[model samples]
Target: MTTELSVILAGGGTAGHVSPLLAIGDALRAAAPGVEITALGTADGLEARLVPAAGYRLETINKVPFPRRPNAAMFSFPFKFKAAIDQAKAILTEAKADAVVGVGGYVCTPVYLAANKLGIPVFIHEANARAGLANKLGARKAAGIGVAYASSGLAGARVVGMPMRKSIAAMDTAALRPAARAALGLDEHTPVLVVTGGSSGAASINRAVSASLPAIAEAGVQVLHITGAGKGITDASGALLAGAGYRQVEYVDGMQNAYAAADLIVARSGAGTVCELAVAGVPSVLVPLPIGNGEQKLNAADLVGAGGAVLIDDAGFTPEYFATEVLPLLANAPALAAMSAAARAQGRNDAAEAMAAMVLEGTKQQSTGRHPKMGS
Candidate 1:
């Protein structure tokens, strides 16, 4: 008899966490056609919208962040954590979950602790080189650890390169350009640069790109800019060349088209985004986010160190530099091709399939009464 396979996938608050969770869930669904999947997230996070939209059931937990100030966090931390843990356990139970997989976020913490308490196996996927706080807490504590970067702090971690959307695995780069360009109303002769600030938009990157549109356009390169929600546009279109169109979007539901349209890309170096770029064989100029956890830097480092990308610090992301850097690269055909080749060589598109299979294998082993715990 085939054992029922069900999972409670807990992770999400921001796009950073939610995107990868969806990718993994999508992969899991494709691999196990009969598997049951449910997502756990907070009521207010981006996940509340993204989860159900992706066609998975989403259960909300009551969670609040612990502030750095002892005086402030001390007053409310315990109650918040307890409520979240209780909610997570309820969701896990209701989902009839065989395993709880934490994709990383405050959402992961409660599911992890609850799974630990219930004797339910907890597994975590850490997508960055520098692990997030929640994933770090669950790293050794969980039964299994999967990482996108080999240098991740988890002691028994297996390097499973970050999973991208299913669309990316089969995307044909050779036929991508002309098709994407035609779809976007772009010319076949001009080179294209795709810049995205993620799903929420990047004010700095946008401002810098606007300042350089004229120069970049004059150099025979077009721009496809994906500015997330609430990104107010300026009157920079008049500055662009007639042949070089600047397509600005609030969000891109079809990201495969964006990757397919461009010769090179400029974006924040988050693990999920970088993995997609590598898998698509798209060359990129990675500008790491100057924020908590140094995750963007770590993600970019994984590619740049492998000769798969060009790393740019956020501080030096000036308009002139972008124009100068991008123009020369686009003008040089062989270099662009080489970068694309390197990006493809560094990617593992089969990672999700491999990870899902491995997880199923380990879970089956545990069912036989032999526990598998990672050594920290």
Candidate 2:
């Protein structure tokens, strides 16, 4: 049975949604040479730039965000939503898709519904521990669902973990450590701490860490702080902090080096970062962003509960707390090693492959000529 498979991956809005979509696309292409993969996103989302940049054909639909409150937008929601669904249906019809794999975002809901209506199988990947609204809706009719965390609360969702990009999924920390350290101008013996709040940096983490820089330096550990673009914070030298193993860059082209050189990580618990840290076997102190639906808190729960990382409230993650909690943790070699081991144990390195298999299995079922309707 050499039926060619065409899969449409629907997700966008942020890196959390788009990253996994790209990962699965990469997996499908690698695992099956002839598979046709297309991405469904909105022009307003990060996916507009990222999806095409990743070398996948991106078919955009209107951004049809669900109205949370009763208002004018809510009243017009039906017409706009139907238009988006029609757009998605057109793309699927042209691609002749066998299945849809939705990662969840503003664009995913319409695509999922359209695929279901067309009798095409739909699979889902819920990246956050707390499932997003689009994914929650998509899961009801998804032929199979893969969740990043066990606590995602999606019925019939299997814990297939977060689908990471190839570089991260294949990284060997020990092998990359020396070069990573050298590139950062760090000494081999000095422990390194990497701080980041994703690509856009977090103000709270930046302020706390910047204020505690001297104290952090006093602990005999080096630091690689990614301050994010436009954060406007600098070092004692009035630069972006480059002095004696305490380097701060607005961004790094590749995070492989950062992860390779890190003995401990101080960052927000975004689903992507959490999964990357676990896969790389890096210990972390997670200070979840205190906003939205507390998804960041949930994102850190698996690693925190497994003793792989520590969770701190954002309000309490001050310079004082860093001095008391982080500095001491840095000095403890055994604890760091144990935490690294635990993180590795929780890592699902083969998540992309697993998710790819699920997608293919759903496609295979679709080929059986008797498509089982997903939901009653």
Candidate 3:
């Protein structure tokens, strides 16, 4: 007899956490049409906007907990964590969830505890090469940990590549370009440089790009810049292109088109974005955000070491250096091609399917009260 499955997919705060959630959700839906899936996230994170958009019920929790950092939020954690867990536990009971999948967001704190308390299995997926604090904590109890990198620290962890979005995964280099370029109004003769500061935008990267706009434009290249929502950067006044042909968008809704249109990419080296770039195989200059645990730098270092990308120290990311580093490669097609091949080699196109299989097997095991196959 076939068993039906229900799940609590939990994570948020950033695109890194939320994109994979949707990827896996799509996979699960495709694999098991009758499977019931519910998402748990704070109202504050991108998940608030994305989960429902993906056609799943996203239950809200207390504000996500910040880590060991000292602050008034930290001080109130004891109370908030308790309330969050209670709320999450109630949701799990209502969903009749067989397992809780944690994807490394502060919103996961309560979900982790609630799942364990109810004897529900926890399945965690860590996309970063290094485990985030939340995933590390949750991994200890999870029935299995799915990982994007071989080095991720989760017991029984399978080295599953990060799940990519359906839109991105469907793209083929040859066909994707023409369609994407036409939609963006870019001509084939114009070399395209895709610049982004992630979903939120980077002040430094934007400033540097703006400063070097003239030089970049002189390279006979057109720029597509996603300045982010709050950055308040715009080309409406026509300042960004200023004769240096360009398009400035506050946020990118269709990322596949952007990836397809660009000959080269310049952006932050967040683990999720890096995963996409690697799979897309676009030559890039990785500018890692320097802060927190240096995780972003570590993510960029992986690409640097793999010969897929070049890492630019944030401190040395001046407009002059940007022009110097890119001019040679931009002018040299062979170097760019090699980088693209290398980046593409690093992407595992099957990761999303692989992760969905794992979760499905995990749910089956829990339902049967028996050990599942190792691969499952």
- Each prediction's Cα lDDT score? 0.79, 0.87, 0.82
Q: Which candidate order results from sorting by lDDT in descending order? A: 2, 3, 1
Judge candidate 2 at residue 326 and give its lDDT: 90
Q: Model 2 over residues 226-263: C-alpha lDDT tens digits?
A: 88866757656776655454677787666878899889
Ranking by TM-score: 3, 1, 2
Q: Evaluated with TM-score, which candidate comes out highest?
A: 3
In candidate 1, stretches whose alpha carbon ends up further than 4 angstroms from where it belongs are 71-73, 236-244, 367-376
- Estimate candidate 1's alpha-carbon lDDT, on a 0 to 1 scale: 0.79
* Residues 1-376, model 3: lDDT tens digits: 3446787889998888999988888888899887788999999898888788878899988875565667778777788788899999999988888878889878887889888899888888998878888888888888888888777756678988888887887678657898898887778777888888888788898878777877877787787877887675545674534446666778877788888888888889888889898888888998889776777887777677888898897877888987888655667788889999999888877777888888888777666533222322
Query: Candidate 1's residue-wise lDDT over 1-376, tens digit each?
Result: 3456777788887787887788778878887876788888889888998889989998888866766676877887888889888887887777667777788887788788888877778778888888888888887667778888887787899988886667777799778878778887677778888889888788889888877767866786678777777675656474322224566767777678888988888999988889888889899998888887787887888678777799988888888778778667867778889998999888887767666766677666664333323332
Give the residue spans of candidate 2 off by over 4 A: 232-245, 368-376
